[model samples]
Target chain A: MRSHARIGFVLLLTPLVLWLGLLIVIPHIDMLLISLRERISFGVYETSTAQYQKALTEPLYLRTFWRTAVMSVLATGITLLIAFPVAYYIAKMAKGRLQQVLFMFCLIPFYVSELVRTFGWMILLRETGIVSNLLQWTGLADQPVEMLYNDAAMMVGLVYTSMLFMVVPLVTTLESLDDSVIEAGYDLGGGGFSVLREIIIPHAMPGIVSGCIVVFMLSLGNYLTPTMLGGKDSLWFTEMIYNQFIVRSNWELGAAFGFMLLVLSSVIVWGMLRLTGRTLQETMG
Target chain B: MIPTIPQSRSFRLVYGGYVLLFFLYLALPLTVVAVFAFNDSQFPSLPWQGFTWNWFFGDSDPQIGVFHERGILRAVGTSAIVAGCVAMLSVAVGMTNAFLFNRYEFRGKGALYVLMLLPLVIPGIVLGISILIASSTLANGVWDVAQLDIQALRPGLLLVVLGQFSFITTIATLVITARLQKFDRTLEDAALNLGATRLTAVRTITIPFLMPAMIGAVVVAFLMSFENFNTTLMLVGSDAPLTIAMFDRLKEGSTPLLNAVSLLLMLGSSLLALLVILFQRR
Candidate 1:
C-alpha cells in the first residue's frame, strides 16, 4: 500500500516538476547565461564580460536602480498608512453583513484588469481630467494642473493597484485578535490609545510586516504602472531592463538589470524575515 | 459580560464616513468607466452628449463599435478559447499534483513544491522573456535536428497557452492542495474496505468531495488567463488578446469603445461569479 501511494505521488508530481524545470529553472539558467554574453551589432549575442562591466559602472543604470528602490519603499509606506485604518475598522469595528460588504468593496477593484485600472488613473490625472478641472474650479490653480507623468502619479497607481493585498492580510491578522485582550488592557486602566500602542499594534505587527513585504515586492517588480503613469521621463529600473532587450537588443545588460532587481528584492525579503522574526515561507504562506 | 462604554454618535459617523469614502474611492474609476460606456462622446470623460449605443454597435474607421467590432470580437473569442483551454489544462495538472502532495510523502516534495512557486515570485516580464527564449531554443534545436525550417518559435496561440499555463497551474495546485488537506482519508479507506478499487473509490468518493474546489479552481484559472497581460504581451505572436488589444489602442489614445469593452467584461465576470455563487449555494 505504501509502495502504491508512492507511485501515485510520483505520477502526480511528474508533470509539475517537468513543467517547472523546463519553463522556470531552465529559462532562469538561460537568462543568467545570456547575461554573461556580449551583444554584437547585428542583434546577436557573443560571450563576453563587457556588458556586465558597463551595466555595473553606468551612472544611468545606477540612478534608475536607486530611484526604483526609493519609489517602491515610498509606495509601500503610503499603502500601509492608508490600509491600516481601513483594516482596523473592518476587523475590529464592522460586523456581519457590513464586514462582508466592506471586504467585497475592497476586493472589487481586483476584478478589473490592472491595465484598465491604470488607464482609469490616466484619465483621471490627465491635465483635462476631472481632478484637474476640480482644482481649477475651486480656484486652487490658475490652470489645469499636470498631475500625470510624474513620480506622484506612479506612486498613486502602485498604491491603488496593490492596496487590496495590503488590506486582506492585515484584516486577517487583526480579526484573529481576541477582543478580551483589549478589554483586559482597558480594565488595567489603559486608555484606548495606550491599549492600541501596548497591545493591538504589537499583536498586529506580524500582519503589518507581511503586508509591507508583499506590497514592497509587488511595487518593486511592477513595470506597468510606472511606465504608463510615469511616462517618458520615468526611466524606472525595470524600464531600463525592458529597453535593453526590447529596444537595444542587449540581452546581457537586461539580464544584469534583472539579476540586480532579483538581488535587491531578495535582500528586502531577507531583511523583512529578520525584522519580523519569521521565515519567508512563514510570512508568505 | 461587562457593559462597554458607548462611543459618541460622532465616532460612528466619522468611522462610517471614512469607510464610505474609501468604498467610493475604490468604486470611482470602475464607475467612471462603466458610465462612460453609455456616452455619445469619443473620449471616456464627459459632459454628456446624450446616451448612444453607437460605440457598441457603430462601425467606422477608428471605432469598431461595442463588443461587435471585428477585432474586439475576435480578440474576445481568442481570449475565451485560450482562457478555457488554460483553465482545463491547469486544473487537470493541479488536481493531480494536489492529490499527490496531499496523499503521499515523498523525499523531495518540499523542493518540488518550492520549484512550482518560482513562477509566481519572478517578475512577469522576466518569466515572459525567459519562456520565449527557452521554448524558441528548444523548437529551433528540434527543427535543426529534423532538418526542417521553422521561422519563429515564440509567436502563436500555442506559445501563449504554454506561457499562461506555467504560472496558472501553480495557482490551481495551491488552491486544490488547500482543499485536499482538509479531505478525510477515512472516507476513501472506508470505500476501499467496502470492496471498491482505488480508482473507483477515488472517482465515487474523493472526486465528488473535490468537485466544488475543482470548479472554483477552474473559475480562478479562467479569470487569471483572461486578464493576463505581461506574459501574454511577450508571448503573443500575431493575434491579440483583449487586454493586449486594449493596450495597443490606448497607445494610440483613449476611446469610449475600450470603456464599452471594459463594461462588458465587468458584466460578464460578475455574472459568472454570481452563477458560481448560486451553484455553490445549491
Candidate 2:
C-alpha cells in the first residue's frame, strides 16, 4: 500500500513539475540569460550587458518605459477611485438579488474580449463616432472631433479595461466586512466621511491593495488598449518590446525590456503591498 | 437589514446619480458596438444609414460579410480549436495540481504553491516573449548538436496553446482546489473501509463531486484562451486567432463587418460567461 501510494504521488506530481518547470521557471531563467548576452556576430555571441545598456541609453526606450509606468500607476489610481463607490454599493447597499444582478452587470463587459472592448471604444470615440455625432448635434462642435488617438482616449480605454478587475477584488473584500463594524462607527458619532476614512478604508486596505496591483499590472503590460486607442505614437513600452522582437528581430534588447517591465511592475506591486501593510501571499490569496 | 449610516436626501440623490452614470458608462460602448453591427454603412461609426444584415451575410466584392471573409472565418475556427485544446490540457494539469497541493505533504509545498501563482502575476507579454526566446534557443541548440530541425518549437498555434495554458492553468487550479477543499474526506474513507480500492472510490465518489468545478474550469479556461491576445500575439504564426485577426484588420481600419464579428463574439462569450457563473453558483 505504501509503495502504491508513492507511485500514485509521482504520477500526479510529474505533470505539474513539467508544467511549471518547462513553461514557467525554465523560460524565465533562459530569458534572463538571453538578456545578459549580446549577439556579437551572425552566429557568434558574447556575454555582455549591452542590451540592458541600450535600454537605459536609448531615449525612446527610456521615455516609453517611464510613460508606461507612470500611466499604469495613474490608471490604477483612477480605477480605485471609480470602482470604490460602486463596489461598496453592491457589496453593502444593494438588496440580495439586486446585488447579484449588479455584480453580474459589472462582469458582462469583461466576458467579451479586450479586443472587442477596444473596438467598442473605437466605435464610440472615432472622428465620426457616436460621441462626436452627439456633440455636433448639440452644437458643441461644428466639425467632427477625432477623439480616438490621444493619451486621454488611451486612459479611458485602460480604465474601462481594468474596471472590472478592480471592482471584483473590492467587492470581495468589502462584502466580507461585518455590517456591525460599520454601524458601530456610525453610532459612535462618526460622520460618513470620517467613518469611511477611519473604518471602511482600513478594512478594505487588502482589497484596495490587491485590486491596485492587478489593475496596475494589467495596465502596464497592456498592449492592445494603448496601441489601438493611442494611435501609432502610443509610445507604450510593451509595443517597444513587440517591435524589438518581431520587427527588429532584436531578441536581446526585447528580453532586456521584458525584464525591465517585469522588474518595474514587481517594484510597484511590492511597494504598494508594503505601504498597505500586506504581503504578496496575503494579497493574492 | 440596517442601513450603515443615516444619509440626507441630497446625499442619496447625488449617490444615485453617480451610480446611474456609472452603469451608463459601462453599457454605452457595448451598446454602440452591438447596434452598429446592423447599421447599413461603410463605416462602423455614426449616421446609421439603415438596418441591414449585409455585414453578417453579404457575399461578393466590397460587401463581403464576416461569415464569407475566409480569413476571419478561418481565424474563428483556429481560435476555437486552440481554445478547446488549451481548455482540456489546462484542466487535466490543473486537476492534478489540485491533488498535489491538497492530498500530499511535501517539502517546499508552500514555495511550490507560490510558484504556481507566479504565472498569474507575471505579465502575459513577458510570459509570451520568454517562451518565444526559450523555445527558439532550444531549437537552435538541438540543430547545433544533432543537425535536426524542429518546427514545433517555432512560433505557431502550438506555441499559442502552450502560452495560454501556462497562465490559465493557474486559474484553473485555483478554482478546482477551492471546490476540493470543501470535499468531505470521510466519504472517501468510508468507501475505502467498505472494501473499495482507492481508484474506485475516487472514480465513483470524489471525481463526481469535483465534476461541477471541473466543468466550470473548462468554460472559464475556454473563455480565457479564446480572448487571450497578448501572449497569442507573440506566439501566433500563419494562423491568427480572432483577436489577432481583428487587431490586424483594425490597424488597416475596419468596416461594419468587423462590428458584426464583434457582435457575434459578444453573444458567444456572454452565453459562456453565463454558464460559468451558473456552475459557480451551484
Candidate 3:
C-alpha cells in the first residue's frame, strides 16, 4: 500500500514536473540567458549584457518603457476609482437578486474576448463611429471628430478592460465585511466620508491591493487595447518587444526588453504587496 | 454605504446614477457590436442603414457574411480544435495537480504551489516569446546533432496550445483543488471499509463528486483558450485562430462581417459561460 501510494505520487508529479520544467521554468531561464548574449556574428553568440545596455541607452526604448509603466499605474488607479463605488453598491448596498444581476452585468462583457472588446471600442470611438456621430447630432461638434488614436482613448480602453478585475476582488472582500460595523461607525457620529475612509478602506485593503496589482500588470502588458485604440503615438513597450522579435528579427533585444518588463512589473507588484501588508499567496489566492 | 442607514436624497441620486452609468458603460460596447451585426452598411460603425442580415448570411463579393467567409470559418475551426485540445490537456494536468496538492504530504509543496502561480504574473507576450525561443532552440539543437526535425517545437498551433495551457492549467487546478478541499473524506473511507479497492472507491466516489468542478474547469479553459490573443499572436504560424484572424483583418481594415463574427463569438461564449454558472449553482 505504501509503495502503491508512492507510485501514484510519482504518476501525478510526472506531468506537473514536465509541464513546469519544459514550458514555464526553463523557457524563462533560456530567455534570460538569451538576453545576456550578443550576436557577435551569424549564429555565433558571445555572452554579454549589450542587449540590456541598449535597452537603457536608447531614448526610444527608455521613454516607451517609462510611458507603459506610468500609463499602467494610472489606468489601475482610474479603474479602482470607477469600480469602487459600483463594487460598494453591489457588495454592501444592493439586495439579493439585484446584486447578482448587477454583478452579472459587470461580468458579461468580459466573457467576450479582449479583441472583441477593443473592436467595440474602435467602432464607438472612430471618426465615423457612434460617439462622433452622437457628438455631431447633439450639436457639441460640427465635424466627425476622430477619437481613435490618442492617449485618452488608450486610457479609456485600458480602464474599461481592467475594471472587472478590480471590481471582482473588491466585491469579494467587501461582501465579507459585516454591515454592522459600518452601521456602528455611523451610529458613533462618523460621517459618510469618514466611515468610508476609516472603516471601508481598511477592510477592503487586501482586495484593493490585489486588484490593483492584477490591473496594473494587465495594463502594462496590454497589447491589443493600446495598439488598437492609440494609433501612431501608442508607444507601448510591448510593441517595442514585438518589433524586435517579429518585425526586426532581433530576438536578443526582445528578450532583454521582455526581462525588463518582467523585472520592473514584479518589483512594483512586490512593493505594493509589501506596503499593503499582503502576501502574494493571499492576493493571488 | 450601509443600507440600514438612511442617506441624503442627493447622495442616493448620485450613487444610483453612477451605478446606472457604470452598467451602461459595460453593456453599451457589446450591445453596439451585436446591434451593428444586423446593420446594412458595409462598415461596422454608425449610421446604421435599415436592418438586414447580410453580414451573417450574405455571400456576395463585397458583402460576404461570416458564415460564408472561408478565412474566418477556417480560423473558427482552428480555434475550436485548439480550445478543445487545450481544455482536455489543462483539465487532465489540473486534476493531477489538485490531487497532488490535496491527497499527499510532500516536500517543497509550498514553493511548488507558488511556482504554479508564477505563470499568471508573467505577461502573456513574454510567455509566448520565451516558449518560442526555447522550442526553436531545442529544435535547432536536435537538427544539428541528429539531423532530426521536430514539428511540435515550432511556432504553430501546437505552440499556442502549450502557451495557453501553461497559465490556464493554474486556473483549472485552483478550481479543482477548491472542490477537492471540501470533499468529505469519510465517504471514500466508508467505501474503502465496505470491501472496495482504493481505485474503485476513488473512481466511483471521489471522481463523481469532483465532476461538476471538472466540467466547469473544462468550460473555463475552453473559453480562455478561445479568447486568448496575446500568447496566440506571438506563437501562431501559418494557421491563425479566430482572434488572430480577426486581428489581422482589423489591422488592414474591417467590414460589418467582423461585427457579425463578434456577435457569433459573443453568443457562443455566453452559452459556455451559462453552462459554468449553472453548474456552479448546482
Candidate 4:
C-alpha cells in the first residue's frame, strides 16, 4: 500500500518536474552560461569573461545599481510607514463586517492592472493634469506643476503598487497576536506609545520584515513603473538590462547584468533572512 | 479585544484625514482614467469637450480619430485566446502537482516541492529573456534538421503559452496546495473502504472536495495571464497582447482609446471576481 501511494505521488509529480526542468532550471543554466560568454557583432555570443569584466568596471552599471538600491529602500520604507497604522487599525480596532469592508477598500486597487493604475498617475501628475490644475486653482503655484516625470513620481508609483503587499501580511500577523499582550502592557503602567513600541512592533517584526523584503525585491526588479513615470532620465538598473538586450542587442552584456541583479537580490534576501530569522516561504504565507 | 477608542475630535480628524488621503491616492488615478474614457477630447488629458461614446462603438472616421482601430481589436482577441489557453493548461498541471504534493510523501518529495517553487522566486524579466533565448535556439536547431525555414516553425502562441505556464502553474499549485492541506482525508478512505475502486474513490470523493479550489485556481490563472506583460512582451512574435498594444500606444503618445480599454478591462475583471466570490459563497 505504501509502495502504491509512493508510485501515485511520483506519477503525479512527473509532469511538474519535467516542466520545471525544461522551462526553468535548464533555461537558468543557459543564462549563467551566456553570462560568461563574450558578445560579438550582430548580437551573437561567444564564450569568454570579457562581458563580466565590462559589467564590473563600467561606472554606468555601478551608478544604476546604487540608484535602484536607494530607490527600492526608500519605497519600502515609505510603504511600511503608510501601511502600518491602517493595518493596525483594521486588525485591532474594527470588527466583523466593517473590518472586511475596510480591507476590501484597501484591496480595490489590486483588482485593476498595474499598468492602468500607473497611467492614472501619469494623467494626474502631468503639467496640465488634475493635480496641477487643482494646485493652480488654489493659488498654490503660478503655473501648472511638472510632477509626472521624476524620482518623486517613481517613488509614488512604487509605494502605491506595493502597499497591498505590505498591508496584507501586516494585518495577518497583527490579527494573530494575543490581545492580552497589549492589555498586559497597559496594565503594567505602559502608555499607548510604550505598548506599541514594546509589545506590538516586536510581535509584528516578522510581518514588517517580510513586507519590506517583498517591496524591496519588487522595486529592485521593477522596470515598467520607473520607465513610464521617471521617463528618459531614469537610469534604473533593470532598464539598463532592457536596453542592453532589446535596444543595443548585446546578449552577453545583458546576461551579465541579469546575473548581477539575480545575485544582488539573492544577497538581499539572504541578509533579510539573517536579520529576521525567517525564510521566504514563511513570509509568503 | 477592542482597545480604548480615541474620543477626542482632533484625533478623529487626524486619523480620518489620513484614511481619506490614502483612499484618494489609491482611487484617484483609476478615476481619472475612467472619467477620460467618456471624454470627447482628442487627447486623454483634461479639458473634456463633452461626454462621447465615439471611441467605443463608432463608425470609422479618420478625420475625428473617433473610430476603433481594427488592430487593437485583433490584439484583444489574441490576448483572450492566449490567456484562455494558459489558464486551462496551468490549472490542469497545478491541480495534478498540488494533489501529488499534498496527498502523499515519497523520497525526493522535499526537493521536488522546492524545485516547483523555483520559477516564482525568479523575476519575470529574467524568466522572459531566458525563455525567449531557449525557445529561439530550440526552434533554430529543429529547423536546421528538418530543412525548414525559421518562419515555418511559428514561435508565437505555443512558446508564449509555454513560458506563462511555467510560473502561473506554480502560483496555482500553491493555492491549490493550501486548499488541499485543509481537505478531510477520511472521506477518501471511506469511499475506498466501501468497495469503490481507487480511481472511483478519487474521482467521487477527492475531486469534488477539490472542485472549489480548482475553480479558484483557474480564475486566478486567467487573471494572471491576462495582465501578464513582461513575459508576453518577450515571447510574443508578430501578434500583440492587449498590454503590449497599450505599451506601444503609450510610447507613441496615448489617447482616450487606451483609457477606454482600461475601463473595459477593469469592468471585466471586477465582474469575474464578483462571480468567483458568488460561487465561493454558494
TM for every model, in the order presented, reads: 0.94, 0.98, 0.99, 0.95
Per-prediction DockQ comes to 0.50, 0.72, 0.83, 0.60
Docking class of 4: medium
User: What's the lDDT for residue A74 in model 3?
Assistant: 92
TM-score of 3: 0.99
Off by over 4 Å in 1: A40-46, B1-12, B60-63, B143-146
lDDT over C-alpha atoms for residue A176 of model 4: 93
Candidate 2 residue pairs that clash: none
* Quality of candidate 1 docking, DockQ: 0.50
Best candidate, lDDT: 3
Write one digit per residue (lDDT tens) for candidate 2, span A82-123.
Answer: 999999988888978999899989999888899888888998
The TM-score that candidate 4 achieves is 0.95
Q: What share of the true interface contacts does candidate 3 keep?
A: 0.76
Ranking by DockQ: 3, 2, 4, 1
User: What docking grade does candidate 1 earn?
Assistant: medium
Note each model's CA RMSD in angstroms.
2.4, 1.4, 1.0, 2.2
lDDT, candidates in the order shown: 0.82, 0.91, 0.92, 0.81
lDDT of 4: 0.81
Model 1 fnat value: 0.40
Candidate 4 residues lying further than 4 Å off, grouped into runs, are: A1-3, A40-46, B5-8, B62-67, B143-155
DockQ: the better of candidates 3 and 4 = 3
**For model 2, what is the C-alpha lDDT against the true structure?**
0.91
